[model samples]
Target: MSSAYPTAIPDPAEESAPTTRCRILAVAERSFREIGYQKTTVADIAKTLKMSPANVYRFFESKKAINEAVVERVTGEIEALIAGIADAPGRTAEARLREAVAALHRDTTGRWAGYPRIHEMIEAAMGESWEVCRQHVDRIGAVFERIVRDGVRTGEFEAADPAVAARCIQAAITRHTHPLLVSQTHPELEPSLVELVDFLLRSLRPAREPARG
Candidate 1:
């Protein structure tokens, strides 16, 4: 018996740019979020924006181009948050980490909730946009790495691989971002931004010897 093979898809990144690229990108992001990346088409965006499909092509050659722009926009917000966290003033490395995590969650869930569909698209795009997603992840990890290294250097945290420690810290912080997780585990424990920072600080503290009897 013969088996059928999947067809190879075209890469959207290879297309040429158009004169009204910015306008097309803006409309594309809005449309994609309102409907969804899969359901959205160049024609749909063009119709919503009162433009011809051909005109949309004059801006973005294909739907993939718009998707790339959407991903970039979301990633840009995350990068900005990471940058702000790195620059924030804190008494210790752990304090900085906590503040950074809280800030990231608030910004991501509060201001950018519309991008959840875009995020889902990026994950589904796997082969098409995996590199873009990876780059953003690396950028976030770098911020955490810097905080971890600073903590270790100042005796604020125990010695460990900064890169690995950064990943762990990021994972812990991300887990609290789920609405279900926060609601179920911390419903009554509404932590102020500073309180969240304190929790991270305590977690990063070095172990102490048992008290003598």
Candidate 2:
């Protein structure tokens, strides 16, 4: 529902260089949120900023560039959240992994409900092989890999290749984390998030011993 400017868009300050780009990105994000990206024009963003469309172009070459920047910003937020969950201290890797998966589901579903256009843009970016989209996937994959690595260190999971496990987990959760895939699900036809996470956790757990007589 709120603006989703790229994390690289630096914080604004008095007479700072990043301030102009920051301002432009802020207005453009808001405009996209208000009017879907497909319907929003660079001129619309310029007028909202009280500037000319030509000036908007000075910072961004075209609408496609602006859209990619916005996508990067949104996925940047998601990537940061994934990193935060992976780094959360004092929790077993299982707890951290569950939280990580849940966080992505919540973010993707929330945005899909409130800012459908952003979700649509992300889907298109994926289809088109956008660089930002690749970066987003790589960053998210890294977080999953971190959690898997931690699990192995803690003896909670038995995996020779954390990278493979990480990729598997990421792919397994696509229905919950991908907007387009999620859109196809029927609430009545699917398991709850808790159930799905429980299944994934089982895969990560070490084989249990038989109970002693």
Candidate 3:
């Protein structure tokens, strides 16, 4: 299998300021993937980029800042993917919601199953960079809200408040989607992903009309 880390860290000396910043993050993400973020020092990233630690500091004030930037990039990619599924053409709202949740499960397992140490970076972000984490959560919830509102408008779903229902759905699926839980839990021990999504979808369906006497 191809290594997830880059083959070569870019030489940031000849790069522009923004390019240098992006390169530093690239190297730092690789280092974090190889070794846990706690063990990845600013000096290590600097050495990889063939730049002085002081130069790395010019772009990021400290290790925490670098971790925040990396987390933002990773979470941003995830948000973009989920957003795409939410707005996909020619799909019903129900289909979009099901696919979006499935995508989250697949993403969590596929991305972190190979690199267990990834949890360390995520945990660090949660503990130290909560604002970054919160923004990601909020963005994801917004996507869910959009799909729920679409469903309600089409009479495919019944929700008094789409925003609240969207959050409920997000909370309900946390076990299937959370990295720590997905990594640690035995697959056979939990409800299947399809079953869970089906159950949530049932809850959102509009109530049936009263039967004739």
Candidate 4:
């Protein structure tokens, strides 16, 4: 997998050049959410930001660049949350993994829903940005891999392959984040986010000793 940075941060000097760029980003994010990616345009963002299209273009070269920025921003938030859960003290690997999954679901499905369009756009792009998305997922997978490795080393888990287990954990994590997958199969149950977390943790745990039957 590529190790390059996904989004380049503008110069520090540009940071202090008023809040026009920041305002443009905020407005663009909202416009994307309300109108979907296909309908959202630079003009829409500029009008929302109370700036001319040319001025908006001054900050971002194209709508694609802005979309990349939006996706990068949201992906960073998701990565930070996963990292926090992984680093939390007093939690076993199993518990930490569950917490990480739950936190991801809550953040993605609740507070960060506005950025779903950003993800949709990235998926449709399926080029350079797709690599960025993969790297983002791999970052989360690295956390899961560490948890699995720690579990096996400490005898908390009996998995023979930490990498395989990590991939499974990543699958579970993705399932929780993708509402369509959850809704399509079990429309009736509609499991709470916490319930899904418990389900995933239980699946990852080693089997109990066989009954004496």
Arranged by TM-score with the best first, the candidates are: 3, 2, 4, 1
Q: Where does candidate 3 stray beyond 4 Å?
A: 1-15, 209-213
Error of 2 at 132 (Å): 0.6
Q: In model 1, what are the clashing residue pairs, if there are any?
A: none
Candidate 4 structure quality by residue, lDDT tens digits, 1-213 = 122223477565465434666677778777766676688889988887777899888888998888777777777888898998888877898788777777777776664354545554645445646666777878888988888887777767767688888878678556557532332334375766566656655555666733221
lDDT of 3 by residue, 1-213 (tens): 124334588444443677788999999988887798889999999999999999999999999899999889888999999999999988899999999999988987877767768888888889999999999999999999999999999898899999999999999999988766777666687778888888888778787943222
Winner by TM-score between candidate 4 and candidate 2: 2
User: Which should have the higher lDDT, number 3 or number 4?
Assistant: 3
lDDT of 4: 0.70
lDDT of 2 by residue, 14-83 (tens): 2343556678878877776667667888888888889889878878888778777777878999999989
Name the top TM-score candidate.
3
Candidate 2 achieves a global lDDT of: 0.78
Q: How many angstroms is residue 111 displaced in model 3 relative to the true structure, after the best TM-score fit?
A: 2.1
| Model 3 lDDT at residue 95 | 95
Q: Using lDDT as the measure, which candidate wins? A: 3
- Name the regions of candidate 4 deviating beyond 4 angstroms: 1-18, 111-122, 125-128, 179-213
Taking all chains together, the TM-score of candidate 3 against the true structure is 0.87
Local error of candidate 2 at 168, Å?
0.9
* Shift in Å, residue 165, candidate 4: 0.6
Per-residue CA lDDT of model 1 for 1-213, tens digit only, reads 012222365334323233246667777777766677788888888887787899777656678777876677777887787777776775677667776787777755654354546544554445577677678778888998888888878877764577887787676665455322332334475665455555655655666733222
| Higher-lDDT candidate of 1 and 4 | 4
Report how far residue 67 has shifted in candidate 2, in Å: 1.2
